[model samples]
Target chain A: MAALRQFLTLNAQILYWTFVAPFAGKPTVRIDAIFQQMVRIGVQAVPMAALTSLSIGLTLAMQGSHELARMGATSYVPDLLSITLLRELAPLLTGVVVIGRSGSAITAELGTMKVSEEIEALEVMSINPIRFLVAPRVIAMIIMLPCLVVFSNYIGFVGGWIICNFALDINTTKYIMRLIESADMMDLISGMTKSFVFGWLISVISCQSGLAVTGGAEGVGRSTTKSVVLCILVMLVVNAILTGMFFIIEGPKG
Target chain B: MSETKRETVIEVRDLVRKFGSRTVLNGISFTVEKGDTMIIMGGSGCGKSTLLRHIIGSLRPTSGSIKIFGEETTTMSPQQMEKLRLRFGMNFQFGALLQSLTVGENVALPLIENSKVDPAIVDLVVKMKLELVGLTGFENLKPAEISGGMRKRVGLARAVALDPELLFSDEPTSGLDPIMTAVIDQLTMDLTQKLHMTAVVVTHDMASAFRIGTKMIVLGAGKRAGMIIAHGTPDDIRNSPDPEVQQFIRGEPDGPVPLKLAPEDYIDRLLGHDRDKGLSY
Candidate 1:
């Protein structure tokens, strides 16, 4: 009961501070720090994101084409691939990729800072960690994740199109034109929404894990892995629930 | 140049810190004078580090007052408090060097962010601080490339880089060899004295504490049945009339604090999840 109380109190503080009044007024954020953090989180995560998106897109196209051909609707593969990539697959895969790749690293970095008392060191140096360490991350994710999701979504579409055209004998131009005609603005919005939330979730959850960090190297490692796995799982579960809600709200089609 | 007479830089009165049901620091009070090395000594889990944190304003006191350089800490706004914190320097128990940053970069960090100090001059200052700690040419090395001792020195360099008027260290000699301990103790003394800085060290190292602490504060239960049982010069503290302190300073290996061989009794206090997690370093 004590532990549970402590957890609730902490979470309450996190919610109030992060969403409500952590700081009463805005402070001028260091542009350089945000850029540096962006490089750390987004730029460094490219290869893994690319690889995951490519595989998922390729597999989806290969399977969707074979399945659609039975219904004599193989030409609808482009529309199918585009809708799935923009509305669901791209955001999910991109988020999980970032969670596995950079989420754990973020935990370890902040965890090491916590364990070595560097967080205290920052306080001694008169640095506001929320503004200094955390704000940069939150700001960077807000700015970069949407862009990264867009990139990933585009790459996924291209990968799927390439597979459909070359491997399954569909015309790439027809695929592109179909995507343009059928994929609505909502498709992009939903993908971007998921990506944004996932980004916020990763940073916030990893930071919380960092705060809970103890021991030395081994402890840091454990926290890092835990933060990543837990963040991914939570993101996926939320993704599932939100998707179901969205499908119900948006209905079958307009 | 003539040396100025040292004055008290830090004063604590009726300081208290509690973690829920358990009170870690209870009504502790002390003063750390300028150019004096004050060591806070206690057994494991006796709140030495907690006391240090309270003193540093990392954790606020539940009640009572703390003044550093004569400024009341708790009254300051967060930004105001942050500005005041810049005047103090501290080396953490685990030597909080950023593993991703090279030693030189780490040492130059405060200068880079807080001030418009030139990078070249900052680099020079870092090298000089590193040399003072006997860690001279390892500037380019990442923290992972160094030994524990070297990491501690790098941390010291970074701590002292800003030329703070007060330096705080937690367990400065905790995991070091005897030789390194001696060197670090000497370095701490030399640096503090030369800089005319006051130092407060939280340590379990009796020899280093005795060797360096101009004044020492012993935190434990039962001597006077209180938190801070002894606070005086090392000589005075050693010869204290209190039996608990006598047992401590003499290293008698038997006291009310126990010798860790109580067996079944120790296991009886096992926190099940913590039991699985084992003892922490």
Candidate 2:
């Protein structure tokens, strides 16, 4: 119960600093800090996100082809792979990857700062720590996560095409046509929407854990571990709920 | 008697703080006049640091009134307190320099954050403040690259960058050698005197405390913990008759501080028994 209350309070604070407070003329958000975080959270994360999505795409194509061939419907491989990657796998896998990568990194960085008294130093300087330290990272995550998901979706589709054409002996022209025909804009939109929420969740959870850290080195390690685990768990649950809601609103595709 | 007519920069009345059931600061009260160098001295965990934090508005007192420059800080909102903090500077024990930023950048942080200063002017001020702390030409170096003494100097530079009316230092000489300790004490004295800033320092170092303090207060330890057992000038504190104050000032190992536990209590602790009769171990 305490944890829930803390989560709600943290969420509200982050939202106020990032969105509402700026509109109210506070303008506490630092553009330079946000850009720096974008480089760290989004630009540096491309290779890892791409590799994970590509591998998942290849595995999905191979497994889906095997099952479909047994039913003599092997040509449906492109449709299955594209639809899954676009609607579910892309956002979910991207979120998990970032949770381990940037979420844990954010926790460790801020946790170390807290332990070192840098955050308290900021407070003493009369700088709002939430605005100076947290809002930028949260904004970066919100902006970058969807872009990463979109990149992942594109790469995953290409990986699926390679597998369907080379490994499964499916024609390239047919695979591309089937994928394009099966998946629509709504599939992409829904996945991107989930990615946005996942990004927000990861940033908020990690930053809150970091800010709440006590002790010293041991506390930072604990907060890092907790941030990663909580991000992944919450993203999974939120993904499930979002998927259901999106399904109802947009209806299932393909 | 004439001191009462002087302007009070900080007025702390019956300040109290508690962590759960354990009261860290009892009903403590004191006043710091303008240009006064008030040193808070005590052994470990005597609430010296806690008191400094309260005066700086970093921690809230359980039941007390803290007025800074005649403004009631205990009842101020965070935004109001932030504006109030601009007139004061605090030097933390461990330096608290931002590791990611270079020394010059760290020193210039206040001006940049609070005021719309030109970048060139900011650099010049950073250079000047660093030089004031005798850290000239060390501007480009990160905090991790500097020594402990150097980091503390940098923290001092950052603290005084804003030219605040009041200054607070927490254990400025804690981990330094005697020479460095004296250097920091001298620097602190020079800065306060030169800038005409009211200063409050928390330290257990009797030598540093005596050197820098015009007025002093020593916190009592044990059951009388957090209570101010002695308050006077440097000479008065040096000649204090209170056993606790004398024990602390003389740095005696075996005095009123109680170095050894009683035999019964020692045995009970060793056997994992509760000190109180009704409590289970």
Candidate 3:
């Protein structure tokens, strides 16, 4: 409960700094800082994200074709793969990958800064540590996570294609057409929305844990671990809630 | 000097800070005047740093009032505090330079962020500040690459980048050798004289404190924790009548400040029966 409150408070502060402060003539974070965070949190995580998505896609295609082929319904493999990847797997897997990669790194970096008094130094310099340090990272994560999900979505389709073309011997044109027809605007929107929320959660939780660190080196390590664990746990729970909501609204996708 | 005409820069009165049930600062009061270098000294955990934090508006007092530049600071909002902080500078115990940024970038941070100065001028000021700290060409180096003493000097350069009217330093000479300590002290003195900057320093180094402090206060520890035991000039502190003040100034281990743990805990810990005991001190 206290963690939830901390999350909300940090998020509110981030919103104020990111969107409202510039209008109020207060110091907002620099664009360069946001760009730098984009490179660190988003750009650097590409390979790991790509690998995770491709592996998931390949496994799903192989498994789906094998299972459906037993019923002589192997043609349904692209439909299954597309809907599963677009509506569920892509965002969820990408979120988990980012949580491990960028999320833990953010927590460790901020935790080290907190213990070493760098945050306090900024505070004493009349610089709001939240505005200067956190807002840019949060904004970058928000922007980057969706981009990653889109990229992962495409890469996941490619993985499915590789299996369909070489191993399954399915017609490439039919497979592509069926996959495209299986997913719609709503599927992409739902996945993008989930990725957005996941990005916010991962960044906020990571920053909160980092800023609240108390001890020295041991404290930073502890908080980094805690942040990652908490991020994964919370993301899973929230993912369920979001999926349920979407399921009810979309009402059992055909 | 007319008392009323002299400007009071920082006025902390009846300030008390308690963490949980343990009181850290008790009814502490002090005033800093313009161009005055005030040194706050005490044993470790005696609330000297806590008092400094309160004065700098980082920590709030449990009770009492703190006024900075005649404005009540304890009640000021974060925005108000930010505005007030622009007028003062604080050098932390560690250099506290952003590890992500280079030393030059660290020094230029305040200048670039707070003002609309040209990038060329910001670089010039950074160079000048670095030169002031005798780190002229070390600007491009990452903070991690610098020595501890060099980092402290860089911290000083960054702290004074804006040429603030007031400066606060926490243990500026703690870990450095004697020569480096003297060098840091000299730089501080130079800034104070050249900029006419009012200064408040928290340190236990009697030599450094006496070298630059125009006024001094020593906080007590143990039974007398959080209370000021001595307040005066260097000569006055040297001639202080209180045994606690004398003991602290003369660096005597056996005095009013107890060096050992309480008798029972000491015996228990020595006997290895304190394994389950959390920190009681």
Candidate 4:
């Protein structure tokens, strides 16, 4: 219950400093730091994200075709593969990967700063620690998570295409047509929306864990582990709720 | 003692802090006058560092008031407190220099963040402060690359970069060799005297405290947690009649501050009679 209150309070502070309070000319946001975080959070994670999405995509295609061929419905392989990857796998898998990589790193970095008294030093220097240390990272996560998801979605589709054309003996034209017809614009938007929320969750939870750290080196390690676990767990729960909400609102047109 | 009338810069009244059920600071009060070096001395866990943190607005007291430059800090908003903090500087025990930034960049941080000074002017000020702390050519190196003594000096340079009205140092000589401790003490004295800054320092080093402190307070332990057992000039502290104060100043092992475990308890444990059944080592 104490942890819940701290999380909510930290999130409220982050929201105000990042969005609402900045308009008052205080300029809580630092563009340079945001840019640096983007490179760290988004650009640097590209290869890993692409590789994971490709592997998942190929496995989904191979498994789907094997089952569908037994039922003599092999033509439905592209449709199943595209819909599953677009509506669920792309965003969820991307979130898990980033949580393991970037979320843990962010927590460790800030936790070390807390242990070293750098955070207190900033405060003593009349600097707002949330604005100076957290805002840029949170903003970068919000902006970059979706961008990475979009890249993952594209790479995942290509991976499916390669598997369907060669291993499944399906024509490229037929696979493209079925995939295009099976998934709609709503599927893409809903997936991207989930990515955005996941990004916010990862950044906020990691920052909170980092700032709440005590002890020393042991505390940092503990906080980093907790950040990754909490991020993944929260993303899973949020993913289910969001998927349901989008299903209700968009009415399952695809 | 001195002919000049001194104005009070910091006035802390009945400050108390409790962590859970354990009270760390208990009704501590003191006043620091402008241009005075007020040394806060205590053995480990005596709340010396905690008191410094409360005065600097890093930790809030459980009860009582702290007026800095005549403004009540306990009731100030974060933004308001930040503005107030602009007039003060704090040097941490471990230097607390940002590992990512170079020594020069670390010193230049306050100038960059608090003002829109020209880049060249910032560089000049950084160079000047580094030189004052005897770290002129070590500016480009990261904190991890420097020695502990050098890191402390860089921290001092950074603390005085803005020429703040008040300066707070926590264990400035804690980890240094005797010579390095003297050098840091000299630098601290120079900065306070040259800049006319009111300073509050927390340390257990009697030698360093005596050399730099114009006035001093020593905290008491146990049931009198965080209470000041002694407050006076260096000479008065040196000649104090209080056993605890004398024991601390003389660096004696056998003092009023009790050892961790009593001899009877140790013998009881050795006899396999556990008084603390819940404790595990």
Candidate 5:
């Protein structure tokens, strides 16, 4: 209950700092700080996100074809791969990648700052740690996670296209047409929405864990491990619920 | 013509702080007047740091009053406390600088964030502050690149960047060589005398504390823990009748100021048993 309260309080604080505080004449986080975090949380994770999505795409294609070929419907690979990547795999896999990469990094960085009294130093300097250190990171994560998901969606499609065009003897035009037809804007929107929530969850969870750190180096290590595990678990559960909701809202689209 | 009163910068009254069942600060009270360098000295874990935190509004007393700049801070909101904090600066024992920012940026932080100082002036002020700490022209180095003494200097530079009316330093001279300790002590004295800034310093270094402190208070240890045993001028403290005060100032190990554990307690603790009830071999 205390943990939940801390999370909610942190969420409220972050929201106020990011949205309401500036209009209240409180200093908003600097653009450069947000950009710095964006580079760290989003730009730097590109290679790992791309690699993860590409591998998932390839494996999905290979496994899907092996099963579908038995049913003599191997040509449907593009439709299935595109739909799965758009509606689920891209956002989910990208979130996991970010949890492993940026989420843990945020926790470790802030936890070290907490143990080292840098956070208190900011406080004594009349600087709000949330406004200066956390809000920018949270805003960056929220903005960047969806962008990575969209990028991952395309990268996954490219990986599947490779398998289909070369391995399955399917033509590029046919594969592209099948993918375009099978996936809708709604699929992209739903997936992006999920990614957006995942972004908020990851950054908040990581920052909360970091800020709550006690002890010293071992405490930072513990918080980082806990942040990653919590992010992954929360993402998975939230993904399942979001997918269910999307299914209900979109009504089993064919 | 009436005489002007020395303005009270920090007035802490009967400040009490407890962690669970252990009382760390017991009815502590003190007042820091403008231009006074108040040294808070104690053995390790004697709650001098805790008292400093209370005075600086970092930690609220369990039950008591802390007034900074004549405003009661015990019940002040965070925003209000922040507003109050702008008038003062604090230096941590370990520098506590943001490792990510360069030394120059660290010094420039409060000025840039709190004030609308022009970027050029901010740069100039950063250089000036660093120079005051005798760390000229090393602005671009990361905190990790700097030595411990240099980091402490940077921390001091950053603390006085805003030219605050009051400064709080926790173990500013700890972990430094004697010459470096004196250098820091001289800087504190300069800030107090030249700038007319009030200071509250928490430290165990007797020489540095005596050198810089116009007034001093020594927190007790062991049985008398968390209570101020002596409070007066540096000379008065030197002639204090309390054995604990005499022992502390003289840096004597054996005295009436008991160690954290007595012999029986230490034996019991090592034997993992209750006091006077440990298993006999």
Candidate 6:
């Protein structure tokens, strides 16, 4: 019963501070801090994200083009790559990369700080830890992850194009032009929207799991694991929701 | 020591903190007076740090009150607690220095974070605190760059940055080498006395506790402690015949005060039938 009460209270506290208050109060988060944390969480996350996206684009295009040739529909292959990469693949891939690179690292760093009493030290020093640490991370992700997603979409499409056009002897201009025509404003918007939701997913889940850490080194590790798993799951869920909204009924008109 | 006399600075009453099904601190009570350094000593997991957290209003009690300088801190609002905490400072075991900042910046944090103090004044205060702990010119160094002893000192500097009336330290020398431990102990004593600040330290360090404690509270076993146990000067605690005090002070292997384990477990361990004994080596 006591354990239940503690769990409820801790949960309530996290919800209140993390979600409820920020929305309710119209809190003015510092712009400079947001930019600074973006450099830390998002900018620092680039290398890993780029690697994952490149590999995903290469592998998927190579296999996808093989199936296209077997169907005697090699020319239409750009459409498949276009819709798949933009509407599903690029955003999902980038989301996973960010979860591993930014999400886990943030959780571990903050968790260690919590265990070491650095958070308490901030409290005693009249500094709000959430404002100084959490707010910036959230703001940075919201601002930068979409831009990163846009970049990932570009690179991944190019990755597929390079494989399809050069490696598979497809007409280069025809493929690019076909992709540009088939890929409407909605596909790009949906892709960008996925990035936005993913950014929120990564930040909120990671910060929560990190702050949940208590005790020592083991606790920090546990928090980091939970953060990555939860962020990825949430990102995938949001991805599914966005894909259904943009692609299922609207088709080419969207 | 300069006509050593101090007044009651901290008054704790019926302070309680519970973790899950077990109540760690059950109606614990104590007082720390000004110019007096009180040590809260206990066996590991004896709720000493819990009690310290309660005093600072960091951990709210299940039920009870803490009056620091006669203000009822237990019921204070978050803002009120922040205001009240300005009167207090803490040094935690891990030093708690902001890793993003240098040692100078870490010390300057209290001033910068709390108030729009003049940059020049903040610098000087940071220097004064650093100098007090014999840290001198190591300001630009980050916590990652410093030794453990130096990190603890940087934490101490940050703690006293605000010049708090009541200073609390949690296991100030838990990880340092012996020489460093002694240096920290002497610093706590000299600084506490020199500054005329009231201090409450939660520690398991017998020698340091004996050396620096003007008043001491020994926490013993219970899901909630049965009592705060012995209370008085360091000599008073050393001479105490209470089984808990004797066992803790002497670092004895066994006693009437049940080690934080169940009766069957204790007996099995005592008879050497158990394969694993965590606290008992």
TM-score of each predicted structure versus truth: 0.81, 0.94, 0.95, 0.93, 0.96, 0.82
Instruction: Write one digit per residue (lDDT tens) for candidate 6, span B118-183.
Output: 999999999999997779999998899989878987888888898888888988888778887888
- Across residues B1-281, which tens digit of lDDT does each residue of candidate 1 receive? 23565577999999877788677788888988788999998777888888888777888878889998888986667767877878888888777887767999888887776777888898889888888788888999999899887887778788888888888898888788888899889988986778778899988888888999899999885433228988899998988887778877777788765667477667757644365576653
| Number of clashes recorded per candidate | 0, 0, 0, 0, 0, 1
Which ranges of candidate 6 are over 4 A from the true structure? Answer: A1-33, A70-72, A168-172, A248-254, B1-8, B20-23, B118-120, B173-194, B204-212, B221-226, B233-281
Every model's DockQ, to 2 decimals? 0.48, 0.67, 0.77, 0.73, 0.91, 0.44
Query: Candidate 3's residue-wise lDDT over B1-281, tens digit each?
Result: 47567688998899999999999999898888988899998888899888998999889889999999999999999889999999998998888999999999999999988998999999999999999878889988999999998998899889999999999998988888898788788988987777778999998898898899998998998788999888888788889999988888889988787777788888777768865668464
- DockQ, ranked from best to worst: 5, 3, 4, 2, 1, 6
Reference contacts reproduced by model 1: 0.71
TM-score (2 decimals) of chain A in model 4: 0.96
Sort the candidates on TM-score, descending order: 5, 3, 2, 4, 6, 1
Which prediction has more favorable TM-score, 1 or 4?
A: 4
Model 6 clash pairs are B9-B33
Inter-residue clash pairs, candidate 5 = none
Q: Candidate 2: which pairs clash?
A: none
Fnat per candidate, as a fraction, reads 0.71, 0.74, 0.76, 0.85, 0.94, 0.68
For each candidate, give the TM-score of chain B: 0.88, 0.93, 0.92, 0.92, 0.93, 0.85
lDDT, candidate 4, B1-281, per-residue tens: 35587778999999989999989998888899988999999879888988999899889999999999999999889889988989988999889999988999999998988888999999999999998777889989999999987898888888988889999998888788888788788877876788788889998888889999999999987766789999989999999999988988888887687655698877676766874675455
User: Candidate 4: where are CA atoms >4 Å away?
Assistant: B1-4, B258-265, B269-281
DockQ category of candidate 4: medium
Q: How would you encode candidate 5's per-residue C-alpha lDDT over A31-134 as one tens digit per residue? A: 99999999998999999999999999899999999999999999999989988898899989999999999999999999999999999999999999999999
Candidate 5 structure quality by residue, lDDT tens digits, B109-220? 9999999989999999999999877889999999999899899889999999999999999999888888878878898999899988999999888878888999999999
Candidate 4 CA-lDDT value:
0.89
Cα lDDT of model 2 by residue, B23-54, tens digit: 99999999998888999998898889889888
- What CAPRI class is candidate 3? medium
Q: Which candidate number has the best lDDT?
A: 5
- Spell out the clash pairs found in candidate 3: none
Candidate 2, residue B157: CA error in Å? 1.0
Shift of residue B210 alpha carbon in model 4, Å: 1.4
Candidate 3, residue B130: the lDDT equals 92
Q: Per-residue lDDT for A172 in model 3?
A: 85
